[model samples]
Target: MSPRVRGEEQPGFFEVLGTWLPRQPWFRAPRGRLSLTRVGGLRLPTPAGDSDSRVFLELHIFEVAHQDGPVRISVPVALRSRPSAIAGKSAFIGKLTSPEHGELWVYDGAGDRAFLAAWIEMSRREQGSRNGRSRGRAHAGFAFGSPWTLELRRTGADAPKEGVTRSIVRREHADSQGEHDRDEIVMDLLRRPAGEQDELLESLITLSEANCEVIPKVLGTIDGAWKQKDDADDAGYWVSGILGVIREAGISGPDGTSIMRRALQAGDDLSDSARAAGRAVGTFHADLAGSFGAHPQTQEQLRIMTANVQSTLTQQWEQVRSEFDDDEAADLNEVIDLMRMQLRDADEPLMLQQIHGDLGAEHLHRTAGDAWVIREPEGLMSHALGLRDVVTVLISAADAVMSVAAETPEILRAAAEQEAAEAEQEGQSDAPAEPVNFGQWYEEFTQAFLSGYRESDADSAGVDSVFFRAAMLTEALDLFRRWRGQWVFRPSMLLQVDN
Candidate 1:
């Protein structure tokens, strides 16, 4: 066994993580040096009958102090005797030289198969044990369903023999017809543990219980407790929730590639797919509402939401106004004024319900049976306008189409010439016109999505067009502000069709 150093004696592990954590995509540290202190953690034993004794699995929670504030980060690490080629260099955290273990290879356990296998085994073993009970305290235990790995490995014939009649059975039967059928599972590690108040696990349970087939099934979850620095109790006092696991039935691919990009690349019409996605989202929303219940927004709530939107509009305009020229500025100002007017006119009471806070085309995936399944529904809002989710989807679809259009040779050349001309003229004119087909494509997608949404939940379909338009404009301006002076495209181009 590798020597486990405690407190100030563990310089190698802490130093390596301090340098590596900031470079990660999920690490949300501010733009400066960070002071990382190990707050709390748990170590899990390897799976039964495993011969690799040198490999150790641990979930460590660190209190990362930056300029802003302290952020708790949960890092699941797999310490191995040698470098892991399968986990690849991307998952490699850094080499740790331990006195007893010599050179140990440290990797992010979220990507390591061994770590995953061990985690699943632990959860399964602890399912009915004393650690599995929910005590309404910090030390609530494991909650899980049937093991997804075993289910995935089962053949259709075997399932029927066992009288199993699930959607997964149908999915497996379809997979048996193809030679490329492989078992893949996707796990989400909460970088910032939210303790028992974590909405993701609750949302997953709600959706799963309601038979919401549009999402991945909840396989298992490990809820652990850790001690914070400010805890007044003992050292090992359980204080936080740790990890969640879900079974991913869809085929995996590159993260940046969305369904829209795939459709465009294959030159396939996405109207049908868009409609299906819309229906899936609608069903998801309906299920969420049925589980959590929806309420009509109060006048005060409406007033506050409108004020926030207007404030965002003003702030974004102030930040990006310098990027636009005289003509472009006037056009943008017109859009902002229209948005304000629409906000004022949008006084109709809307239903406030649990919503998928960050819905986009990228989060939508197709399973082996070509059914749409939504992934990464982590950002669940307890009470928000369902239109917010719809608007986000619409904007994402438009952005996808715009991205494809921008890549075409004609549009690229036009953009280049326009940029050169604008430089020469000192940003005096408007942006170049969009491609002729761009508006049509965006319109087709929008209509198909709304149609699907309406078909699923007619009551939620009474969306105020003026409010939707205002929300779209607000989202576009927010995107522009986030782009941070990248003048490749203007927000005006996005709203030209609507205008």
Candidate 2:
């Protein structure tokens, strides 16, 4: 058995790395050991109810992803005791047979309750459907139905214990656990390898000194590490009641929708709402640059992650190539090669600035027209071109809105069959017809999403990054095909042959 890095002398945090990590869409590593460290945090528990650990237990597991690379994710885990029998695919992270009723798996009790309630109320309050928001009322609740990983698990009406302090601020811990050092380590973990901490601190200080209100104000770091020049906001890391703000935003009305609404059957109302949302994103990014400085990466810095990107693409591609076919594979390879060249040429100022690695209609707190700002709590994740985030978000939204007329795997077979049939038609060999442009579906789907992203002149070229990222995606799909014993074009065929 592999030796455990932790959980011996200290309280057990769970092996989640093995059983849980791979299943997460956000987890990058195929498998890597997770080391718990103190980033920065707070403990907010209401003094009401049983204090029995079940009815009232909210531990905000503020975690920072420390896997190799620049991707830093904020994982806020809420654990609450609940009635038993909620077992299924998740199996509740783990189970326990309490002396009370029966077996109970540690589950998300504060799931979306506070967060969603706040969000819903805020949305409704801002727009009462008169503006065509509210998912038309019928679909409003439906939109919130599926569990989004980004959202906490508290879904039902389960209320927080009364008298619980609304929220308390936390401070950065002196202990080096991932918890305490999250903010500091995030920059170290994900920022430019050669980037100095002093520079980041200076930029942050500049923002703090500016006292920017339109931008997200740093509430002081968990530690005094990010202290402002004015020394005005630092309260030694205490939690504040984000609840009222969250709730007000929720019922505020239809703030935004996916830009690819047409494909998803979203009407003008939602699309308009989404555009309004996009404006917020634009403002947020602008504010970030203003606060953090328009500083771009030096050429010397590019070399650092270039190798990492290449390696990640190569490795992940081998695993998922079955997800695409011969023509698709060839096309993806060609696009990636072209894109790399373009990126190398355009590897100029804008590509390197601090930007959100992931953005979506879901990520926004509220509409720009209303009151919304970047969730800096997510921290800055190291990423490729600025275009990467817009493309990814559009693709993801498209995936959400898409009806999935053809099964993804079936599309692969159709791609291969089409190639064989086309060759036969040209007097090479005879085979059945393949689905007409099996990948056209995904292409069209992603393009519809691109509509919103491309609307901004600054973001159109990012479509190219999607093509390169798709190369890694294609390779991984191919690997999946190999595993399934279903097959397609050889990797060589996808590569250009030397004359």
Candidate 3:
């Protein structure tokens, strides 16, 4: 049966959503009265002989008006006869009194198991079935001849288990995370629907097709076209590209702590795990290159990169000159000059390939079996220097180390003061100990990471030190601009590019 829209038949559907939509963390809009117009939607069918047959699963697309422009937001809703105990309070939307269905309880479908199952099933059907059709009402002057079309693809070989529980994991990022059945599958619902250039889905599909084992296994993808609010017919004129994705969840440690957090707690013992992560990343890069094909660095690309680096350095210098004294300014200038020289002298052959645009410790996790699993490959660039990813990871590692090391001086000072007081009371004198070299740890970590990277990929003969140093300098300047005093001298110390 074709999906139907019962919003008109059900009373208070829009009113209920207006009150609930703004409060959601996924909803990207100003917290005020929003002019929400229903643009398009789909009501997915539930499984046969389901426990909760009365539940209605729906995915609604609404165009919200703002000062800047109109933004389309997708809200997957589950309407039940009564409030669900499993969904909890966080997933609950406002209750509505439907004249057709009586008193109904609404919940965010992303968190509901029924909705997820239906979504996965629909995606799976698209993989095997040829007669699957997306049908909706038609009107005059429609650009497309057919009704809305859903193009869902299942990438993973294994099917999700039945009766799996669902839970939503909220992160700082724009997308929404939904975990199924205790780390079985992690679904990321892409909140902002990009029309055609869906980098995340495209990257996943490419990697999955290539059988990249380092990344999380992609299970399925949901993408399609939907009718616009002003469209004459139900034939979709607007593309809702890559709505959501399902992938296997990364295996965490025995204590359930993330690899990044573990590194922060024990920086000295980070060599092995750091090396494993680096090797995994190297393998990931290799797979990406193999899938998408790599190319030699071009002169035009180099020129553009150099210009961007120069612009960023100049801007950062202008922003931070007033914050430092003459000596500090001289040191900064020296570093900037050194970076410029490195960029100019970078003549070595480098390979350009699709890169993980944002690779950090947070995206890496070590399993209980000591294998490293990479996550969140959403920030992907089709063409970029692979060293960019390496530089990003190194910068992230530096920040993690410095954040803890920043408090060491004050802690040591307090300890020394306490010791001196005790000694004075006892009529004894003690010499101060040598200061700890925190930078040495970061240096060791960097070497280990690079070593692992080299060990993993033979194609990566060696990293161009000049370009690496230059990238680090540019990253440092950018960090300093954002963090100001907190990051003023730390980057220089941790980077040690001069050495």
Ten-residue region with minimum lDDT total, candidate 2: 185-194
Give the clashing residue pairs of candidate 1, or none: 226-239
Regions more than 4 Å wrong, model 2: 1-274, 340-351, 365-385, 402-499
Per-residue lDDT over 255-292 for candidate 3, one digit per residue giving the tens place of the 0 to 100 score:
11244444444333567866777788899889888888
Write down the lDDT that model 2 would get.
Answer: 0.36
TM-score of each: 0.60, 0.37, 0.68
C-alpha RMSD (angstroms) for model 2: 17.7
Model 1 Cα lDDT, one tens digit per residue, 182-230: 2344445566765667566667766766667777655456665556655
CA lDDT of every candidate? 0.62, 0.36, 0.62
- Per-residue lDDT of candidate 2, residues 79-192 (tens digit): 334533322334244444434334333433223133222233222233222222111111112223322122222212212222111221112232332223111111111111
The TM-score, computed over Cα atoms with residue i paired to residue i, of candidate 3 is 0.68
